[model samples]
Target: MYKYNNFYKKNFIFKIIENDIRNKKYNIICTRFPPEPNGYLHIGHIKSICLNFSIAKFYKGIFFLRIDDTNPSTENIKYIKSIKKDLIWLGFKWDKNIKYSSNYFDLIYKYAIELIKKNLAYVDELNIKDIKNYRGTLLIPGKNSPYRNRSIEENLELFKKMRLGRFPEGKVSLRAKIDMQSKVIVMRDPVLYRIKFQEHHQTGKKWCIYPTYDFSHCIADAIEGITHSLCTLEFQDNRILYDWILNNISIKHHPKQYEFSKLKIEYGITSKRNINILIKNKIVSGWDDPRLLTISGLRRKGYTASSLKDFCYRIGITKQNNIIEISSLESCIRLELNKIAPRAMAVLRPLKIIIDNFPSNKKIKLLIPNHPNNKNMGYKNIYFTKEIYIDILDFSEIEKKNYKRLILGGKVRLRYSFIIKAKKIIKNKNGNITCIHCIYYKDTLGIKIDKKKRIIKGIIHWISCSYSKPALFYLYNNLFIKKNINNIDNILSFLNKKSLLIYNGFIEKNLLQLNNNNQHFQFEREGYFFFDKKYSNKNKIIFNRIISLKKKNN
Candidate 1:
């Protein structure tokens, strides 16, 4: 609730809206999140999704999910489906069925023709390489194309031929006839349309010519009655081109474009190109690899939707770029999970322990609280048995100063059970610990021991060897070792080798009830975990470690 204050306090977009309303720029507020359906949505897209949708919701305006599928060469239905799925998972709703740039291809072509009829646009015969050469550098003004003076009749005929696939790809392109010497490079007669002989995914072979993004986006916004077009700051300069195209057209409604800073995170790359490289190179399992920062990956990694939304809200929106520390995101997940995730016992690395004094055939049940701070969650029963397993790291063969765990000849408490004292240590060939022999004090159950005589300060979690279920655990770390990926030439070398660590361990039998419950659980002192839906089956259970209890230093 307090996070919304940040958006209203210093937000330039909201201020712009307020000024526009005062100046009677528009009667109603409307916004759109137009994504290119070429790749899956990344974590950076989450902020844009929240900003655009929340702005519309706060103002009671219409929000649209428009697919900017201008380049049919790379667009596909899979990416489109993934985008919609990710948006729904984030809990945002659109006003109607998804909109696509392809849906307005016919109208867009007419608009391009309109620009040409007014001599504001022309079909150039210069090849792709020659056009770039003439575009000039930052220090020089771009020279006009030799075909710039083509007759309006000739240009219209050439454009028609391009649509009919009579011209080869890369032979010619439609360009806006703007001042080539303008300070902004984007205003230097940007390309309006290109000839792509390849078949389109949406329109198929209906047409070979496609309108460029610069030509399609703004008009599509106007056709949808969008009032405020919110996008990343990189498009700030393109605002001129956006307005130029819209104002030049005969459209009655002209939507204003507003730009905000893009989301960047430390140790992760959000660029779709780089992510695609990682996928192609097989550095990651897929787009949904938990080590990745993509939304699907985060979902697979057991992050709750509320936590992601909270993270976006807390970070707020700003005009300057900032690299958010990954730990800040993790903290949000941990905070949310601490309140909702149920408690369970899991042994990531098991060490056999035998309660020698207890009867081998006897068993007792202890009721453990599901959550320490929330009583309404109630409790679950765990069995106490002669044979149990503790984490190997919790025991030491030789006693050391201030050691709090099961050092030989030392006493410790079994969580929710009784005090136990180590009597002997069993070792196998090559001097490796195979089992620990201990004796439990029968009266110590649910009672505090005398401080002077007990000398027991350690408490650890364990599972009954007989009742625990075998499980596979996946521990994940950041995908990249470096905090920045500025040098992309050798970026693959920076992939974190320890990004994923696997272990075969045991979990409490009671956890089987969570098979398809979509629940997160804390393994007592170990860490938070969830059933891995993508890799789990009836015969075997695989879990992904959500986050460890370790706190990151500020």
Candidate 2:
């Protein structure tokens, strides 16, 4: 095993593992990320994936990608494939071939038989509702089932019948013969196996009985020689049963279970059930709709793996659970994109500007740096023509206080070009401003003019009307308006109806020369955007806004 390093020493779980290593507990440490193939992996799973995979890599140990496909009624092959693809996209390599709980069904069933022979487990005929009543509440001790005291031979026979498709779904279940009156509710003779008539995606219809997650999880861990079984705080109580099953079983290399707080973000829905509801109602486009917090959705929205990993590391590991601000996660992507995304200018809501002083036939090629701070990124050629488009928000007929953008008879500097003074405005019959006529100072190009004398204190990005290409823009925002959705009964009521806003815009024509590599670009004074390859074609180009530019600090 590799020695514990300073980087991982801060994590409490790593500290525990380091102590085990120092005490010569085992030769090699092992970990696994076992996800149920019921839904797509979300932002919440990213933390666990990073923690489990990072710990194993840091220790030079083994890590496995196991599919916890115990309940086949909800599981599907698509979800399993999505899980593997997400892991690979996030840059994690699992050891050997992928493992499945279904692969060890025969062994787990044999272990169940061993427990029955040892008189530690018994088959229960109690219905689901009656079993719940017998389980009792946290304040009350549970009562034993009527069939709890069945003879070992009878219990074994009934269990074998259950395995042989003799029992219908929910007609019979195998429960561990643990304390029925225990204060911990899960230890009140928890069900180990239940009859599932549904065909499993992995095992098909070979067997009619299925093992519960609690029973299969620990045994699978021990069988694979997993040293640390890490899960979220919700599974902390399940640890009792995890230990009980492992301790009574005739298995070696029992792994210890540890729990940490799950990652939760404000206004973000990570629950697969709720997301499915949204999909069913057509509230979102699909699983990768970019509005959802699913890993695929984030990827479609241009969130980089490095940024996500940085977010996970910054959140760190802890026992206390809390809802993190969405801005915290947004900061990670913003910071990263600022460094790498090339600069471009786009006018979402365009207002035409005609420069009267500039030559109508002459077009100046202005070389602008792709990155403001990085000189090594070089520059791109942007055309400066007599007619151009500026964002409608950048101009006003009646300027408000502190508004520095263009105004009638007022001057503002065109970014990287010339200082232009708005002389007149053209309006339609409806009184909506359609265009602005301006005059440009030819000598102001690349020069720091006297701001006090000219009263020109604003700079706005513009694209040449003759040289730019028409494009579509998709602006995305939070799906929910409410910050704390825990108490809300109907999540749809709080849905942000205007979460996705579409706009018709123009981009630099030079961008068409670049390869279709799904590149991310920072629209000057706009935001970070990803070229939508799926929607874009030779006739129409589209860009999806990942996030808006952050407000600068004064």
Candidate 3:
């Protein structure tokens, strides 16, 4: 297991940001999570959400959830709704209605015009390829566009015409007038605006021209008076353009852009395009597929919101890019679930065990603690009977060394019940063990046993056949076959074939309490589970295995 320090302690990044704020004498601290409404939010996004919102909460300041819906081609209302749902589900509350970059279109357009009149930006007629060729490589300085010296009057008129849809798509673009010979290629006159004759999810057809993220992001942050524009480390180089725009534009606020490393897991990929391919190929169910790392997916898989928050905290904030072992995330979930998930009994691959000595047709209700360490969780009654079901994996005809479970002619303790000894085993024609005969000790029910007298080392969980409820158990494994597959083209090929497995099982009646309360239950020796909200029905109880009792594959 991986060890973690106190995540609540303010780290170097927070300390630096705090010192900078104090030096500026800023009273209100404002932070924002600006995600483009192009796809569902994934696990990586949660880190930013937690960091930004936690910082705001720590200072009792303002935190805004902003949708950067500049490109209408990919943005949609569904994505916006999903993003909001995810943030809320993660236990975060925004100050007001969510903000949209589209809302500042008019102001952003006016600012663009302001830059045009000042000769800081101009409209260019270069096609995509010509523009790329002109933007020289790292070692080479770029040549200025022939139209880069367009007069202010002509540039303003052409920009107005372009917005009016008079210019065909790709025929015109607005480029910043930053030095073409600058060392940073991103500053070599990046495109500020482009024409896209598409319907916007929010603004409809009111706009034919949309500003690029590089041009609109800082402006939106400024308009909202954001004090700290926190972004992932990938945008560390973009910080210059982020500042350049704000420096040249006339804005009321100048937010400092801070970049931190994004969250990434070794066995998982969070890119939206790759995830969408998985959905489109029907390799998985949907975005909420339990095997996926998306917030909705994790929720459907029976992970608790608190556990996810704990994971984010454990990962902490850093400027260096790193791929964390997926086990760390599983460990966090296991640790949290172990403390909170109530214990219950279940038999995934059941083998019939008949306690021939016990009274038939008699129901013995035994009270078992819901949680071993937490007495406040109270107790539930598990009905014990003559015929009960134990996991088939817990038994063996030929015992191996150090095997602690049931074997022919061996004695074992049934959890929450009696110490029983296997007397005889009935086999079918195929040599498959169909049933086992056992004798239960009458006085062994929930009592302290003398180990010398009984020599019982094997203890197993079982559910009474008479009182157990039939359930469908869905087991989830890691989705990807490889630990680290960064290339998008090869990611799908590494999809794990055994990612999901379903089994018909039996859960003790005591589990109904947890099911009814929407609580997670640890199925003794099996794993943590909860009701499958989408597939369960009156006729069939479907439970999703959140994670296993054993450590996951490293």
Candidate 4:
């Protein structure tokens, strides 16, 4: 229960709440996590999700999941579906059906017209290329558009024509009339609506004119009665435009925007632009590739829903931008799986063990406990035989004074099995040792009964080599090899080449019960692992290592 001190609890939630209340803070402040549904969610999004949702829960206010799917050209229904799946996987859910920027399109258009009536916005006839040029340098104010002085009726008529598809694409755009000399580029007459003749995934061709994310976001918050519009720090520059829109329309309840440092995760790229490039270039398998940091990929790679939520809470909230070491995620998962997952034996690089004393046809069965720390989950049985397998790395053909593994005349302990001493070695013409022959010590079963029995320093896991089951084991880790992605010129250079090293491995028999929907387990002396969404079927079992064996006594 000590974990409750650092974990989510009602006491801690309101404890922070009372402090904010006693400080004359805004009352009943709601928060919203507005994700643009253009790609699968990532670990970076998890940070924002936790911050916004936890604050809402902590304050006893409603939290909203609003999809900012205004840009239909780059957005899709597929992305929205993925976002909803990822969110539910993370264990956070909105109370009602989710809100969408496209859902409030008509309201946003009317509000834009309100701004037009007030002469705070106008239709710009400049080309996108020419508009950037006319915006001038940062040091100088942008020159006013030749069409800036158009009458409100003329601008509204043109806008109506734009809505009715009377204008060609790139002919004109509805832009805010804010001063062009403002330090933030967003304040320099930002575009509100564009003439995209493409069909929208949601509205299906009902409307041709679409509002930009910048123009639709803040107003959507107000419409949903969201008190705090929590978002990333990059949007800080756009806050002025958000406020300008609110003031122009005089919304009864203007939402306040708060910016926190965006998560710049090490070992991964969170930028949609970069992810899109990866997809375009065919450098990855897909958005759901196990190497990817996207939620789809993580789920495919065998990460559990609770592990992700626990990871977010462990990182907590901070105002400053920091590249989290990424090992923090590894730690959280290892801790989680170790507690819930069953214990199974697997040998990735098998070194054949031939028991000399036991008959070749003899077998042994182990009733091993599933989870050692937890009791309700009882035991499992693994069939063992004379011909068993241990990791090759756990042995040496040449005798080692310090090594207690299967060296000539040395004793070693098989994990929860028996004690054995090496007697001979079997090799092939290629000068490779294929099998190591050892004698089982009947006097010393798992632990030595006699104090004088040679103390074995080497302990290892072994599966019946004669009754081996073919399984694909995946070794997964951070995708990026470098710490600072910005420091590297090409993202491919940072790609961890060793991210996934797949190999054939042996598994205990009961493992059949542990291969669905990310059933997790820790292989003795190997690492924590789980079943990947891919490569998992009743006929074939595939697992990906969630983390290397914990770095404690091991």
| CA displacement after TM-score superposition, residue 257 of candidate 1 (Å) | 1.1
lDDT of 2 by residue, 1-554 (tens): 11224437668999899999999997899999999999999998988988888899998999999999999899999999899999999998999999999999999999999999999999999999999999999998899999988999999899989988988899989999989889889999999999998998978899889999999999999999999999999999999999989998889878999999989899989888899989999999988899999999999888998888778877788899899999989999999999988888899999999999889999999988988999987788989999999999999888778887898888899999999999999999999989899999988899987767757858999999998999999999999999877546689999998999999989988775652453799999999998877767989888888988989631
The local distance difference test score of each candidate is 0.87, 0.90, 0.87, 0.79
- The digit string of per-residue lDDT tens for model 4 on 1-554 reads 11223544533333555566788666786778888878889888987888777777756788889889888888888999999888987888786888888899999999999999999899999999989987887788788889888999999999999999999999999999988877777888889999998888889998999998889988999998887677778888888888888888968888777676777767788777777777887867789877777888878777777777777767665567788777877777777777877777888888888887888777777677877888776787777678888888888767666555666677778878888888888889998889998888766655544535556656778998765687889887677788767445578766777877888878875476543333777888788877764567767778888778756542
| Residue range 358-430, candidate 3, lDDT tens digits | 8897888888898899999888888889999999988888778878789888888999788899999999999
Candidate 4 deviates by what RMSD?
Answer: 3.1
Which residue pairs in candidate 1 have backbone atoms (N, alpha carbon, C) closer than 3 angstroms, thus clashing?
Answer: none
* Pairs of colliding residues, candidate 2: none
Poorly placed runs, candidate 4 (over 4 Å): 1-28, 399-404, 449-457, 486-489, 514-518, 552-554
Q: Estimate the TM-score of every prediction.
A: 0.95, 0.96, 0.93, 0.91
**Residue by residue across 285-318, what tens digits does model 1's lDDT show?**
8889888888899999999878888888878888
lDDT of 4 at 530: 72
Per-prediction RMSD in angstroms? 2.2, 2.3, 2.9, 3.1
Best by TM-score: 2
Which wins on TM-score, candidate 2 or candidate 4?
A: 2
What is the C-alpha RMSD, rounded to one decimal, of candidate 2?
A: 2.3
